[model samples]
Target: MAGRTLIFTGPPGSGKGTQAAHMRDRLGFVPLSSGDTLRAEIKAGSDIGKQAAQYVQAGTLVPDDIITGVMLAAVSRQPTSAGVILDGFPRTVGQAEALDDGLAAAGRKVDAVIDFRIDDGLIVERIVNRRICKNCGATYNIRFCPPKVANVCDRCGGELMQRVDDREDVIRTRLATYREQTTPLIEFYDRRGLLRSVDASREAPAVESDVVALIEALG
Candidate 1:
């Protein structure tokens, strides 16, 4: 049987990555994140990796064609039964259309697009104090959900550091960019009848439970 596919879109600090990871485990879907793919490719030092490195280092988006190509490649490698949960791609209407076309060519279509809705002010507050473990990528919000120990990762005992992009000014710019670009993509999926908006301001488990309910409802 053809497996299910889901897309996740939201503001930078809305916990899309965390939610996607949780859903991957709970739903048995392969989590494919564009940022992770690009980072892996760049680390591999291939031709495309070299090309993506420059943009990533400069804190700019890689070109759409490159990102789309990478996404298609990632999806092509998955087992038909495994399925996929897409994260951090198709940030615009054009990209969404292209994604649909690409999936159609592969005899697949998006089953749902979960949009993590959170207030801009809350997003700013969450990101400003966010700490990430460099070793395991565990994220903690200093203000709300700090690690068990100060400046340390509970999972790996690694040092925790705030991401440069999570600074107040940078986060504000990222949020502004999301409003201008990613917001339209939400409408695109909604119009296609594949969008599900979930409140992300709650605890992580609560958010995950709501997403699980949405998936079950889709069945």
Candidate 2:
């Protein structure tokens, strides 16, 4: 059987990445995160990374070609029968089209697009209360998943600190950008009958179960 490809999308604090990671771990799928992939390339300072950095540093969208190239390369690395979970790509309708085109060239298509739904208010609250390990990058939430010791990582014994960008004003701005840019992408997938929304305000396990059931239904 051909691999199942799915896209997980949402605002910053909506747990889309967590759900995508769950699907990847439990189902043996590769999780390809556009942000993470691009960041890696940028850190490596490759030619393409430098090109991407120009756009990123300028606070503009990386040209669709560059982003699409990264996504295509990631897909090429995976086996034909290995499902792929896309996280944090296709932020705009144009990127969505680019993804479809790239996948078509590879003789694959997106099986489903899972949009995690949560309100902006809750997103702000969730993000502000969250902290990350300075050493190992493990994430914790003050309200949801506090560490064993206060303000420290349970796994790595690292200091946990809040990101500067996680402040309320920055989060609100990100939400505004999401509504402006990402909503159209959601509509694009909905038009193609590939969009399924999961209530992301629920706990992680519940959302993961909903996603698994949705993919199984697609089969």
Candidate 3:
């Protein structure tokens, strides 16, 4: 529970973001999501953002170096007291090494890496049924966590719609790529004794409880 950096990884639709939100609140740490940071930079038209915008527009993944630089910059700016909860960053082994180096330079290192293990069939179903609020980016699973009204966001009253990438084929490709690229990162953390595996097939509250327990056990 003390200030420490934590990285979370999982395939798309695995509820990593939901758990990250819980950890951020419970631990009082900044949740640093690489996707959110990159989007913000791209919106601001920063130098790196311009480069990232091209890949994003073309539906290509941003290069590892660009993502590493952006993430390191974000980590450097985090307040010392709160530390950080990293999500959707270090997708590759190279980026993981770069992140470690960045943290070393900052006089810190990764405290833990939590990987959410879930079945691909479940992921496909979850993505297909998922609805997101365009205004606040809040996600709800139609089958599991439907909004107050159909196609409506409970928090903001925003119109909810399925994301294009959440389609069947796209979800398959994303899960495949995640397995291909992120498996090594998982091993990398595991070797360092910082990896914690959680069953993501259960309910969100159960998964969050497991993660909290794991962190407490580590302490």
* Winner by lDDT: 2
* lDDT tens digits by residue: candidate 3, 116-213: 99999999997899889989999998898899899989999999988898899999998998999998989989998999999999989999999989
Which runs in model 1 stand beyond 4 Å of their true positions? 43-60, 131-140, 146-163
- The TM-score that candidate 2 achieves is 0.85
Per-residue C-alpha lDDT of model 2 across residues 1-219, encoded as one tens digit per residue: 889988988988899887778887887778888989898778888777888899999999788889977777778668889999889888888888888888988888999999999999988988999899999999999998899899989999999999999999999988999899888898899999999999999888999999889988987
- What residue pairs clash in candidate 2, if any at all? none
TM-scores across all candidates? 0.83, 0.85, 0.82
What is residue 47's positional error in candidate 2, in angstroms?
5.8
Q: Put down candidate 1 lDDT per residue, 17-94, tens digits, no spaces.
A: 998888778888888898897777788876777887888889886898778777876786787777698998888888
Off by over 4 Å in 2: 42-50, 53-61, 132-140, 145-161
Better of 2 and 3 by lDDT: 2
Q: Give the local distance difference test score of model 1.
A: 0.85
Extract clashing residue pairs from model 3: none
* Candidate 3 Cα RMSD after full superposition onto the native fold (Å): 3.7
